[model samples]
Target chain A: MKSLNLQRVFARNTYLISFILLVIVLGINYIVQNNVFELRVLNNNLRTLLPLILLAVGQSIVVIGGGLDLSVGTLVSMLSALLVTWVTPDSTPDQILLAVVLVCAAGMLAGLVNGLVVAYLRLQPMITTYATSFIFSGIALLLLPRPGGSIPRDLSTFYRSPLLDIPLAFYAIALLLLFWSVLRTTRYAQYLYATGSSGAAAYATGVPVRVVRVTTYVWSGLFAALASLTLMLSTGGASQANIGDDMTLDSIVAVVLGGTRLSGGQGGIAGAIIGVMILRVIRNVIFFAAVPTWSQTLVNALIIIAALAGPGLIRLIRRSIGR
Target chain B: MNAQTLRRYLTPPLIALLLAIALFFAGGLINPDFINVTQAINIVRLAAFLGIISAGQTLVIISGGEGIDLSVGAVVTLAAILTFRITGGDNNLIGVGLLASLSAGFIVGLLNGIGIALLHIPPLVMTLGMTGVVSGTILVVTQGEMLGATPALMSTYIAKPLIFGIPGVILIWVALGVVMWLLMERTTYGKHLFAIGVNRTAARLSGVRVERAVIITYTLAGLLAALGGFMLLGFAQTVLLNLGDPYRFPSIAAVVVGGTMLTGGKGSYWGTMSGALVLTLIDSLLRAMGLAEAYQLIVFGGLLVLLIAVYGRELNLRQ
Candidate 1:
């Protein structure tokens, strides 16, 4: 009975396990490169990781709200395409600012489409987003048929520079966490969790289930737009139609690693951020470990599979032991 | 027939057939040659690849519990590469190549089934992860060098014009479709699949071997996807790095458009056939229209969303 309770507690707090895993990976990364904590390395890594971190945070909300947004990557592409295509070389700061606001709004609008379709039309989230993904990418492709556009170099340089002795990315992370903590205290968050955990029960309990679900996706879209902005900053505002495609899967992996149940109503964004960190650190390990270029993709995939399967295996073992 | 009977007859396939006919005429309006008999053959020939791939997809979807095989595209690619390596364009080694591809698919399907059933991983994540693993493995193994040529026998018989100027692949597709139809509609396994899909615990309580059925269904899907890859090799005569990428989403699109629920359990293979043809016709029409790749993608995506919305909305309302 005691063992069962212990196992149950462990299962209940998967984030704790993820934290340990993150620490272990960081330790390994430090051993590989002793100067990993140097400001330069930290800044470079954090900046590179910011986009995925933001994406995973968005994805966690959707997953927690019992939906999945396959188009998050495409949304990123679309916004980036819009930003670079509109923000020409000689564009004024006001124009750039206006373009940013419009692109973010467009992202929210796109999310509204997804939310409306999935929540109101009652379409399956998986297939619906999958289809819309093409639409988003198609628009992105139309905006920039080829991958040749530039944001202002000064803007990119400014984004790369540190602010007040700390990297800009740290502040961004802090802001996101603050937003999440504030949101968590709201009744809507409780409703969101209730709806995801059991929609029928939540409805019976007078929760506005549909509204909560739709808002979650809308929130996802806003975060996706933010991720796109950070990605553009990191990549010097160059845009590709498929730039965000790869990150879709990576964010999902991060969410799973962070102990967010795909089934819904479990886990949090904090774990998701840690999950992204773990994935990035592992990528760094693979790079520094001198793995062959040909085998790199395969090695990364294998590690992902391991990470995705690990928690499930633990739960299974726990169940068997309990029995 | 009464309205109820008529409505029953107007299944997703029949609806798809009607749409296809309209699209066919629309294509003809764009270019008179599009309505020719040759065009019909071309459409079916193109659809043969999707049909075979989707045959397995339909089964997986029917197995339910949010069952889907996102790895189909990757599996097809891996199978094609492995077959090419095994056969090396040698007709004599074709049998060995087929066996090699099917075995590879079986192993993957088995792993997917085990993970989803015994290990309790979500099908979406499990298959998606499998796609990465399989694609990554292929990249490492091939090192960007895709080998092997289409054997003359396959090209001549299966791909090129044969008896009555019809491709052999279309005939094979018909045969496979019929067999899958019978297997799903006429057999005990079919009933078991539907039951398990409808409700797993209930099915288990009723003494259905749910795990075995799921395992078999996924294994079959994997094998068929590999077979489809072989067909693609025959048609294209050579494989490229992203050869199977095009078929990945379309197969799923076709399956869904054909009336299969994404949530699974209730659908028909016949519906999927028309869905494949409809999707193929759209592709041909888009190409014929001289649309850029971007527009083509937009149309494809938009049409799929429209179809899903049209079908799915009614189901939700009824519920």
Candidate 2:
């Protein structure tokens, strides 16, 4: 009985379970590739994963707020296109910074459209976002019909640089966590959870459910822009109109693996971050395990499905045993 | 009928018809030749493909409880590839091709239903994962190069006009629509689906087998998707990796625009047919106006959002 109680506690904390899984995966990764934890290799991996990590954070917020953002991928594509087409290598640093601000603003505006349509119009979030994704991609294609542009080399190289023998990615992650931590303590976070858990109930209790939902999407949009920026820096400012379509599913998968329920309410950004790392590490493991190149996408998807179904399977077994 | 009841039954189909007429006039204005008999035939042909796909989507959505099929496009793609492979472009092997494609769809839907119903996975994640697996399987099988000529009979007889300038494919679509209408409007299964969609616990307590209904709904969706793919092969005369790509979002858009509730249980295949025609007419109008492909997509998305918002308002008011 006591053991079951402990199991219940652990089950209640998805973060704890994800951390343990992350540790196990990292240990296996180390065994497979001795240089797995070496700062140089680690930096390269983290840099590659930075875009998805950022995207997962935005997606986690949406899922926690009882919504989904299928448009994030297209939003990433649109912003990245804007960044590359406008922020030329010869442009002054101030111009580049202005471009960044502009892209972020565009993202928030796009997200605001989604938020208003969803909140005020009470449209289905899933289908509304799916429809809007096409618009975003269309704009992306119009912005950069053909992908050929460069951000400054100095800027790209700086994004790769390490601080104190740890990659800049570590610092960015720390900053993200800090931001989330601060946000968590605010009244908005409590309202977000309440609204997501039960919107009617939240409304009855005098929560600004519509405003809360809209703000969450705006935050999601801003983060999607940031993720696009990361992708731009890593890829040396190249842009593709369809680059972010696949990442939408990847972000949602990370959110789920991080323990956020798709139905909404009950997960944190920290777990989401860990989920992204776990996904990245699993990809690394797949590489070292010599999985055939053509089968990697298939294998990755299968693993995700397994991960998603794993907790439910365990619960089923435990319940049947108890019965 | 009273205004409320009449409005409930008539609003979606009426909206769809009005949208089609508006687009028709717009096409006539854009390119004087676009409203003629030839163009009208062409639009029906185009709408037929989408109509078949939406027939399945309409059912899935009507079953409710956040039911959706993200794997529709992927399933159609796989079905087309397998059918082509099985037939090897021979008219004589058509039976084999159809059987192979239909069975493939059935198995995929059965697996989806199992995961969603028995395993308790959310429908979105379940269908999303199914898309990956099915698409990945196609990739692995084709080794990134899948090419097959559609059978000659498919194009010459099935797709092209064979009877008094009416295409066989259009007839098939009409037949499908009638059958589906009958199934939904005149059957116990249809009643059960709506009941479950409206309230699963109530349906269960009232002796409806929710799980079975959901499973059957998904399986039927898979079969219809595969049928749509087979027709696409006939129309296009070839199968490519991305053939099913355009149909994915449009399938959902068509169903939603047809007046089916995104929340499910209150829609009709007839409404879906008109919705498909509206979208096809819009596409024709866009082409006639000489909009770039990018603008076409933008307009499509924007129009979908507008239509859904209008329908959403009506639903809210009724509630």
Candidate 3:
């Protein structure tokens, strides 16, 4: 009976909502394209959303931990620009590896900077992240101009490579999910959640609130680098400017729709995955709906309003009923 | 109030205006055209649109503790594009254009309000979600194409100066500013709005109908954002996809720069007014320098950080 109840709960869980959206999209795609099985096609698009997914997941974690990562999109853009400008085919395999390592390291450092500013300096999370995003993207643009890149053949293949009709992004995503699962079980995640729920309460209970807050940003930054890496591979390269232009909002939307609270301490990454699926599926719907391309924004606005509204509306109904 | 409290309360807007003046003088030194009558008029006109949006933004932020309306940008974009699309370059359709744009925004705003108020949603996350939804809608509707040709009548306002070099756009802005000030100060509804923002629980205790207050504030923001969209259509002569991009956060920045707290409870329309002009001058100066978008963004970022530091440092030290 307990297992059955758990199954029902998971079935209705927002974290699982995106998976349902994925299934629904595939069903529609199969009917339209007349191919019930095209694992490769699904993998390819998921690959495209991979970097964004990473950013979204990372952002979700931060928000859940009581902060917002407004800079994730810009950070990805900056990293994309940095790698494209610094790494070349002639730079040898070792050089390429070194560049990758450096970029990730730099990303972590940037995240630390943001975390410290928010946790120690006690700045507003959104504003602090927004400022850092601008700075990071500036540095990125200083390195490269426009959106052109020549990512090495090996790097591109690894990101886009098909294994048994499944794209590599799926693997990357699976690995990240595993990591998050482990992280969730650890003391760090517990401390992060406790701190977010109430800093005073957490500190009173002997939690290292400041360190957790700062480290969460570090985690967010590393995730951002990973996101940019996947995007760089898929896009074939990056431009210093506007590389991750859309990632910031997309990630935020995903996190929110996945049932994570932006105010912090009441959400998780699992929901972000589903949020990405719903968002991507919605995009696909726009293509088929034959709406004027410009109308896409209007439709997006409505859907987002709906997504954000739905949860609140449900809660409101429950409260009113209770009253 | 004590001196310390007064200074704490006054820093955000005071610093913002000071920065604007500093940037203006700096720009004037670099290029005198940056401070001419024509330039000043143009900046006012642009700031008017932002003011309208921020007017609504201030109310919402005041009303909810975690409240913010990030959907302002997307709303402006949607309204601007729709106004052009329906008008189809025809002057006769100007009224229709305005109606459609406003209606779209209104409906969207209503949804946002419902989500935030009745549903007990955190306004930031709620609006953030709406941004994607609206942006995706833009992509589908515009399909990478933009519309130009705002009703020439609107353009004439900018072209003709009724006050000896003061463009009609500036006058329209001033008029709107006066009206907003009146609405916020003299009206019972406005008082209620202020009450909710300062203290939600206390306001509710006083029978302020907090939910209604929040809903109306968001709806007001929606209308103002649409108005900004309409103005942009006339101002730019083309409804670019990302034209409204700078408006959203800039309006928030302007409001903050002018004296509004992100945590809500206190803000000034006049401060926001000054804030918008200051931001406009900064950008106009940067554009005059013919710098690339990247450099411009970096400078703006640095400036914002500096202002935050100056203002926030004192506050942080106090707390």
Candidate 4:
């Protein structure tokens, strides 16, 4: 009975597999690099992974709400471009803060555009976001025709530095989790899941499915803004038009690895966060394993494909065995 | 045909045709040199590559289940690289190169089919993952090196006019277009494809081999993408890393602009052909204007959104 109960609990927790995978990968990482858990190393690693972590969190919410945001990465790029262009190294702290607020607003506005088209206009989310990605990338290119910008060294130093021996990234992550927990308790969360699982059913039941869909994109945009800000600070404010282009797919991959259904309404931000960490650690393992430079991409891609196929393959095998 | 039936079949392609012509004249206005017949032939020649690749995309999209082939670009790159390696700029080995490239594409498509159709992986995820795998394979084989060239005869065929100021490549595209039209309109496979796309469960109940049809569609898409890559080698006259990368989104965009529902079950290759021409014209016009890559991206994306807004909206409220 106890074992059955445990099995049920495990089945109930969609992220359990992702969490286990993370633990295994972390262990491999530690074995490959003995000092991986050390404070400074841990902090540095998390710092680098944080931008993607934030992006994945946003992607998770969007996916959970029954939509996808291919434009999130470009939105990050555009925001980063806007940030670097707006705030110079010599700017006052007040100016930097104001720029950050404005950048966040722009990010939300971009999301609103995506949402309105998808929600009211009833366009497919994937294609809509895919189309809009080009616009964001174009804006990014226009803003930073060349990859050049400077943020104050002091700002980056502050971001890198620990307060009370805890990394700032940890605090940011904790705050994000806190925010999610709060949001999850609200009625909006219920509506989001309902809409995602079955929009028609949800609409019949009095849910404002369109509004919920629109809000999901708004949240995604806001998180993307945060991700862009984090990325800019990490890179010392040097901006590139294509800086965030690769992260879009990576974020989706991370979200999936976290056991979140791309079909929506079946996952959490925690799993997505863990998924990002697993991905990062897997890269670390590759680096420490000293795989040939030429074969690294091959190895990485093979591993990812295996991971993506694993769940389906397992189910197939189990069913065949039962037969 | 009655007006309703004619309108249903013709409206999308008509809009695309009108757009292409408007853009052509618009290009002439931007650059006086762009209005000539020579330039028009050049645009068609260039569009042929995109059209061929999008031919596969059209089949995949029409098969429904949110089908897409992101790996088309990677397959193109792989095929180009493979062709260069096989032919070594020798015309005598061109046939061998074509066979090898097409087989490689077939095998990749087969894998994609098995994953999506049998294993029940989502098409988007399956194809995206396949893209990574294919790209990784390319990197491994090439080791990041630039090597080999197109056969001299092939390059000439692609670059020079063959009959009535039309490049041989354009003729190939025209031939492929006709074959595609016949395949989609007259074959049992095409009927199955449409039925499956429109309603998978219903098709299955009605005795359609949904999996087999989907697998074939994806396989053909892969084959066509490889063909595009082979032609690209001729047009480019040399191999380049990620040669097909530029066509990935454009192929989908062409299919979408051609009035094919991304949701599946309604579209035509003729519409896709016109859509490809429109896209090529947009590129030419933008280039002629001397706009920066940034502005070009802006206009291209803006135009895609505007075009889709014009015709791609879902009629259902619960999307």
Candidate 5:
């Protein structure tokens, strides 16, 4: 009975594999770069990784709620563009605060548009977001036709600075986790899981699945906006239209690696955050391991594919062994 | 035909056709050169590449189970680069290049099929991962070097009018469209595909070789994409990194715009063909209007959303 209970615990812990992978990769990174754990280095790494962590967290919410937001990356680009273009280096504190609010609001509005289309129009979430990505990218390009914008030097320094000898990113991530924990306690979280697992069943149970779906997208948009803000601050407010294009796929990869089923209904933000760390550390390992630049993409691709296929391959082997 | 028959048989492609014509005329309004036959043929010629690629996409999508070929763009780039490298701008080695690129495509597709069908990997994830792998391979092989040019004969075949001022590429596209239509409409394989798309378990229960059919579908998609890439090589006359990047989303868009359900089980090559035309017309019209690239992107995306909203709405729960 105890063994069975342990097995159940192992099975139920969706983050187990991701956590293990993160530890292994982090170990490798530390081995290759001995100073990886230094506060300054850690701060620099976390700052670089914060944007994707935020994006993946948002993606996880959507995935858990039975949808996806392909436009999240482009939405990041659009929001970052808006922030940098509107809030100049000389902008007053009030202006900066107002611009930030408006940018985040715009992101939510975009999400609302995606939500309405997917829920009310009953369109495929993937295609809907794919289409909207172009719109977001277009808007980004229009707002920042060239990659030139500046935030105040002080703001960037503040963003990069350690607080109490710990990275500011650590505090930010802790706040995010706190917010998620509070949100997790709500009934909406249960409804989200149920709706994702089986929308028809949830509907039959009077779950208001459509509204749940819409809210998930809204949450995704909100998080994507936050990610954009982090990215903008990290880059010192330089904006490019296609800045976040590559992050979309990477975000999906992180979500999947985090043990979130791409088909939806399982996993959490913690696993996704860990997944982002694994990805970031993997890059560090490659860099420190002195992998040839030309072959880096190849190596990265192979690792991702291997990681993606690992669970299934393991299951297949287990079944064969059982047989 | 009866109204029901007409709606069933004609409405989707008809919408695409009308949109194409309207966009063409709109371009003409901006610049009369757009209305001429030469320009019209030029649009079709350019669209042939996308139309051909979308043919493969149409099949994969119709095979269902969240099927999509995100690797097509990577495959196209791989094929174009491979062809250029193998042929070395020599007409004598053209056949060798074709054979090599198609085989590469086949292998990639076979792996995709196995991963998705046999291993139960989600199609989107599998293909997306494969895109990364293939693109990475491209980078490794080329090492960021630009090399080789399209052979003279190949360029002429793609660009020059052959029969009554019709480009050879257009004829090739027409022939391919016919083949795709017959394959989808007249073959048992097609029936099995549609059945699998609608419901995989039921199709399996009814004796469809679901795995084989799906594997074959993906393989064919790879072949078609490679073919499109080879033709693109001729059209462009040189290989560039990420040569197929631009074609990726547009191929999927063409399929969707052509009224193919993203959920799969229902669509046609002809609809995709017309959808390709519509997209090409939109491009020409935007260029004719002399809009900046940013504005063009905005208009294009907005119009796509508007079009999809009009015809792509899914059936509600009650239905």
Candidate 6:
């Protein structure tokens, strides 16, 4: 295994490249600032980022199954606003849990609507998700004309606390990756990949393509609900209008960077986690290095292009060598 | 022409525009002044802005290959920003501003074309990515500032009727509609683009420069989008950071609702022209009735669903 081409293995999983990049970027920052791996800064950034990472993971699931759920970002913002506003300051832990469950149920119902529309009415996924974004934002804005919320002291401390001198958010993500990997080996995973890679082929093999496609969205909604909970807690409240706006854009970038094909059927949650980490890390690197805003735009674009270019280059090389 | 062909050509746009008018009048009964002449003139002019943007959107979609420009709004905003910065205070700088705006627009189109055509990137993702870069560039360049103040006298003239009843904007719309019609119906370029869109493999087999067609179509779309942006120079009085934003989705909406197939093969420029006007009327009428922004969105969503139900086949959402 060691001799069977280790570089080839790294080239195949984009997350490894991003992880290496993350290390290099952090190293550069440490060398320059002499922060020497500060836990405080890392925790501070990760708290703001927990919701997005969760959102991206949910998006990755659906994208891998050959569908795009534009509603998850909207769902995150909507559910966060609703849960925060509805869960009053006087609510007990059990009541808060009930409220959280209700939010997840609502998200499930919304996803059910989206799935039915796309499957039964045969609406385009992009348009379907887009229309729901409007519906969700409307409800969100109506619920709170401005940002407001209060997490119980216990919950706030729970999110803010460091478990074993490291951010607890990191631990939750590690657990999520484990769950994602375990699920990857299941029959549902096999069907999902088969469906995304080629729906017609999967259908011929009795994969129940429609059921998997539709169910993926429902589960995505559930994941989004969990994300919203963390997000609201992380922010210590909700903001009016698109609290999760960046998630939609960043999620796509993260999924794509994580080695998932935009066209669908590749990549994993580990890859997506790395993708998010890379983005979050580079942002800090930019600020630390004092890169100008204008140059940063071009640099980010170049990096995204480079990340995508690798797979294309490997394909080109493979074709030449095979011929 | 056969009766079916004639009806097919005329019905969708007619129904769509009529529905919009009906909604506007319904909104008018509630607001009272929405049915008046001044309102009519304003609706027509505003429709022209969306119509120009949709004109470009229609081509990009019609050229097919799943090629849609998400940068339409950003390009327009960038164009607006550049025109303002270059022209600055003097009215004479309008010419220089236009040129500068156009060149910037072309560069955006070039980037989009390279991503989609040369690199074989997915249109939706490529455009989405380009949007981030372009919008970020806008923010970085502008530092969140607006530029260029329009001349008050020119504004009054632009708002007034060019001859007896039609305003300057209506005239531009009419001229654009005619040009688009000719290019689409009577020209070889239009035929070639449609051919490429419907089946690129077949087009390639037939010796069409498929890459060049996709590239040039996107380029043209960009140029036209910039033209729409510059026109706002006189209309909006000053180019703000997001003047181009409102134009983005509405332009695509106009194109889609106007009877263009989303998969790109056959489409109607005249339909898009009416579609643009119809959407503007709905928006303005809603505003007149004192509908809250939230409810306006609700109505907008309902309208889109209603439109799709009526014209599902044309949308190609069936397959």
The candidates' interface RMSDs, in order, read: 2.5, 2.6, 3.6, 1.7, 1.5, 3.5
Each prediction's whole-model lDDT (CA): 0.85, 0.85, 0.76, 0.89, 0.88, 0.76
Error of 6 at A46 (Å): 2.4
| Candidate with better DockQ, 2 vs 6 | 2
Candidate 4: TM-score, chain B only = 0.96
What's the distance in Å from true for residue A114, model 5? 1.4
Error of 3 at A234 (Å): 1.7
Estimate, for each residue in B1-319, the C-alpha lDDT of model 3 and write its tens digit.
9999988766666667677778777888887777776676666666677777677777776665677888899888888898878887788998998898888788777767877888776787677667667777778766677755677876766535657777666676778778878877889778887788789899999989888878888888888788778877777777877767777777777766676666676766777887787778777888988888888888877766665655443133222
Instruction: Write down the TM-score of every candidate.
Output: 0.95, 0.95, 0.87, 0.96, 0.96, 0.89
Predicted structure with the largest lDDT when compared to the true one: 4
Which 10 consecutive residues of model 3 chain A have the lowest summed lDDT? A28-37
Candidate 3 per-residue C-alpha lDDT over A144-244 given as tens digits, one digit per residue, 9 for 90 to 100:
77667777787777777787767776777788789888998999889988878877778888988878889989989999998887787887774557778
Per-residue CA lDDT of candidate 1, range A1-323, in tens? 88778868878887987888889878988888788888888989999899999999999999999888888998999889988888877889999899889888988889888988888888888889988998999999999888967778898888888898798889988998898899999998899889788777887888887788888888888888989888988888788889998788778878988888887888889888999999998888888888898888778777766776766788788789869
Candidate 2 residues lying further than 4 Å off, grouped into runs, are B1-9, B314-319
Question: Which runs of model 4 end up more than 4 angstroms from their true locations?
Answer: A1-11, B1-10
Which pairs clash inside model 1?
none
Clashes of each: 0, 0, 36, 0, 0, 0
Docking class of 1: medium
> What is the TM-score of each candidate's chain B when compared with the real chain B?
0.96, 0.94, 0.87, 0.96, 0.96, 0.91
Q: Which one wins on DockQ? A: 4
Q: Give lDDT: candidate 2, residue A13.
A: 84
Model 1 C-alpha lDDT per residue in residues B108-210, reported as the tens digit of each score: 8888888888777778778887887788888888999877776788788778878799999999999998898899989999999888888899999999999
Candidate 2 lDDT, tens digit per residue, A194-230?
Answer: 8788777788888898898888789889999999999
B1-319 per-residue lDDT for model 6 (tens digits): 9998877756777877887778777867887777877778778888888888778888998888666777899888888778777767467777787788788878878777867777676676677667767777887777777755654443554556777776776788789999988988898788788889899999889988888888888888888888788777667777776788877767877877777766787777888887897788777876787777878776766666556556644222113
Which RMSD values do the candidates have, in order?
2.0, 2.2, 3.9, 2.2, 1.9, 3.6
Give the alpha carbon lDDT tens digit for every residue of A1-323 in model 6: 56347667775765776667667766866766666367987687787778878888888888888777877887887898889887876888788989989989988887777776665565656556766776777777777777777777767778998889999888989899889879988999999888778777887888887788787788778878888888878866645667875587688777777767766677777777777876776666666778787667656665666555555555566668869
For model 3 chain B, the run of ten residues with the poorest summed lDDT: B310-319
Which lDDT tens digits does candidate 2 get at residues B225-258?
A: 9888888888887778877878877898888888
lDDT of 5 by residue, A229-294 (tens): 999899999879889888998898888888888777788998889888877887788889999998
lDDT of 4 by residue, B63-169 (tens): 99878889999999999999999888899999999999999999989889988887777777788888988888888888888677678888878768888878988
Query: Ten residues in a row with the worst lDDT in model 6 chain B?
Result: B310-319
